[model samples]
Target: MSFANCGLPYHIGGDIKDRSKLLLQTPESFLARFNVDVRVMNEVVSINRADKTVTIKNLIDGSKYTESYDFLLLSPGAAPFIPAIAGIDNPLTHSLRNIPDMDRIIQTIQTNKPKHATVVGGGFIGLEMMEHSTNLV
Candidate 1:
């Protein structure tokens, strides 16, 4: 399932309340409604523009294959800017990006029960996190 990624921070801070509400679409729904074959766990490793083909990697089974396409749409999403700093690799340090990252952050808050938290970025999402983190205190 693909989620409304912008709502991830709100979901973390209890503003979203319902986790399922974040899910925006499913592969089956896309296939049924739009006839789009949404391959969830497949990654396009390489694109051959000359031949109009793409090399796909199955993330789950570690298999690789190529598929020819009339038109290719590249929709790789953004990643957080993790600065190179001391102790940045520590398990406590987390970046909010995808569903797994959000899950880890939530699990850390619940299981570790830390008294304090640090938000790195000062963008809109960062401010939302800071406000929500304070509310959780």
Candidate 2:
């Protein structure tokens, strides 16, 4: 279930050459291998412990339905800590968190071809971003 390869951009030299190599498993493969139901683009809205049911909402369509579950495990992934800074929302500024974030960063780097990139944080992700930016330059 781990889709976020946070360090992938750095490993692949900013541009992902082959996406199939990064894909750990497809939904069909996951289902066949683990025998677990996989529902994408769905959000868990609420859980009713009294009735042992949970409400799930479809992200694409504004539809909600309830399903009974004997046990539930929640894994809310971490998001990038975007500080409130000037021009942080600008199209030139970018942050890498997931695959899409990395893609956007790569696209911006290729399209804009900036002379320099200023990474805010000094954490692992930030360092990776710095490395990628340097390589791009």
Q: Which tens-of-lDDT digit does each residue in 1-137 have in candidate 1?
A: 68887888888888999988988889999899999888988989999999999999999998999999998777786788889989999998898877888899899988988899988889988887888897566
Q: All candidates: CA RMSD in angstroms?
A: 1.6, 2.0
Model 2: per-residue lDDT, tens digit, 1-47?
A: 44648556654364656655565766788899999788888889999
Measured with C-alpha atoms, the lDDT of residue 8 in candidate 1 is 83
The 10-residue segment of model 2 with minimum total lDDT is: 6-15
- C-alpha TM-score for every candidate: 0.89, 0.87
So what's the TM-score on candidate 2? 0.87
How close to the true structure is residue 105 of candidate 2, measured as C-alpha lDDT? 72
Cα lDDT for residue 127, model 1? 86
